[model samples]
Target: MSYSEILSFVQFIHYFTIIIFLTFNITNVLSIYEVGVDYHAFGTNFTETAFLTQYHISNVRSIVLVQLQGIADRGANFVTLDIWFGSEPGKITDEHWLATFPMSAQETTNLNQYAADVASIQSKIDDHRLHLNIALFWLGIADYKIGNLTEGFGSDYLNASEFTARIEKTTDCIITAISNIRCSDGTLLVQTVYLEAEVMIGAKPNQDWFISTHYPRFLNQITVAGFTPAIYFLVDAREEYILDKDYIDPQYPALNGHRCMYWVYRSLNFLKIHQLPFPKRIDFSCYIDRNTSTYANLTYHILNDADAALSVLDAPKSYGIAETYYFIDDTQRKEFGQAFALEALSNPRLSHIRFWTTPDAGGKGIHIAYPFAIEDFLPPLKKISIN
Candidate 1:
């Protein structure tokens, strides 16, 4: 071939190769990528257990343990129980069916005993190479009922001061437990906790106290203490709370739940903007009936919004993504899981998703599924206005 013709042919081949490479790259990006699944509370119940088994069956890494209750005698593995304040006063009583197994008054008195109990549980978890997490309710600074009236006398308990004290105590116990446990490589166990919204806003506090005094105080306390905590909004997303003009007050920042999320997103975004450490996970616990169209639609919107936010910041989406394969009972498993999965498939950025209900058998339901992959993506800090 002539020299000019040879050069032209080589150039054509180069261009063709580039085009093919680009096409392949684009195709790969569009293909079905199996992200990780996060089963909230892996050991909570048979459903959680089944979900974890399925996660293993599907080869999912990164799971978040939800309210893994009952920490009585399981050793350091049962450390999760040390933080348990009975859900209600009746549950607190030994005579009631719902009553938590009585701990001797001495067991409750010795602060170190609580520490020891937690440490034992942590040790067990570490031995098995399991992850541990805790979820705390944020009852607004008020006294609330513990349980049903039929079971026990309704009593005013856990006001602001008491709740704060409990939180501090719980934090100390968890920290001690975590410190005692050694991972496979001899590293201390990493822990996470959830701060529930109802616990914060249940008292209907004025917007100022709710946001400034309560919310910021809670965040500062947890952050300064060196625990990785995430804001948990357990609201009925299907309800008209978002649309209600009076649902949230603008002056008091923390009282605004929707705004709280926006603020959190911005705060985390600011950390990314400035290259600081911030919580990498977001957990939104919705009480959707699953069978209702309203539940399906509400969850879909929230998931899509979360996906968009994560994509924009290139952060991995966490929580509300997993399928709840296990339930305390199978009453809503099929319906809920199927609905959750359908909504999950529409999002592409999900890294880990789980479907596990809590309380095992008798406790009130704790069902949540995370639908995102848990990949290590270091997001850059960005400063954004919360207003």
Candidate 2:
């Protein structure tokens, strides 16, 4: 071949090689896993609740049992108990006294007794080599008892050094006991320390400061001291929006009539953007409703948003994941299947959506569906070799 023809042929080969390299590297790829769901509802029937608990234990085995379980399940490897006690019918008084400072000796004794009871349960969990996670929801309990902190307690009361100090003390006691427990791996049984934002700020001034101050301090104390503390966005704001009209309008801009989905989305998005450590588990107290729809929408939106952000950052695949809880029957599952299929097909960033059904009381069941994984679909950089 002539020199010019040979040069043209070489150029064709180089371009072809570059195209093949880009195709292999830039194409969409995902590693999908069959993620298990652990369901927790505060007030389901015993049989129904037991079925749900067993469902989790049978599947994930390393499941984290939360609030409703009276005793930690033998099969679970991680157990979580809420610090707020009022959720249990008999323990309402314990929650009541924990709210005030100048407690009578009886109240203090009752609180400590309840704390000891929790410790006893933790001991059982440790015996089985199960890890433990605690969800702190004092703000929800506080709101349930004291009304809005802004109007009733005022910002000063919420931010009082005395109140915060007491909270720190109670939490410290619980943490100390939990930290002593050990898992099969001989590691501390407690895997995470979680708190609600409302508990930290409670209608105090400068809402972001609630996160900036309390979250960092809590995480630092646990992490620096060699414990893993993950942050969780409390569903309290959504609950408050549903219950109190006055609480809904002024603070959360995302609530619009019956559509507050954006608000939930923004909350999660804010945490993700700030690169806060994503908790492996989450709890949603609200039942299915328009507001719940908003929560689901917000979840998908945040996942998509994360994918976009990761692509821009040129990060690897599978950057983040989120799971949600639901209670639905067979008919409801069919309806959700159709709706989710539509959402999944339309959204390129999403990988898979799965639905789960657990036996409930009276042989009935509840269904939950959520996108279990999210992979970063980034384009590969051009590869050019120099001799």
Clashes of each: 52, 2
Per-residue alpha-carbon lDDT of model 1 for 190-261, expressed as tens digits?
Answer: 445544332323233332233333444455555565556654433344345333224454443433434224
State the displacement of the C-alpha of residue 323, model 2, in Å, after optimal TM-score superposition.
7.5
Task: Write down the TM-score of every candidate.
Answer: 0.44, 0.44
Give the per-residue Cα lDDT of candidate 2 at 54: 30
Q: Candidate 1's error at 70, in angstroms?
A: 16
* Candidate 2 Cα misplacement greater than 4 A, ranges: 1-77, 85-129, 140-159, 197-206, 234-302, 309-323, 328-387
- Prediction 1 TM-score vs. true: 0.44
RMSD of 1: 12.5
Q: List CA RMSD, all candidates.
A: 12.5, 12.5
Clash count, candidate 2 = 2
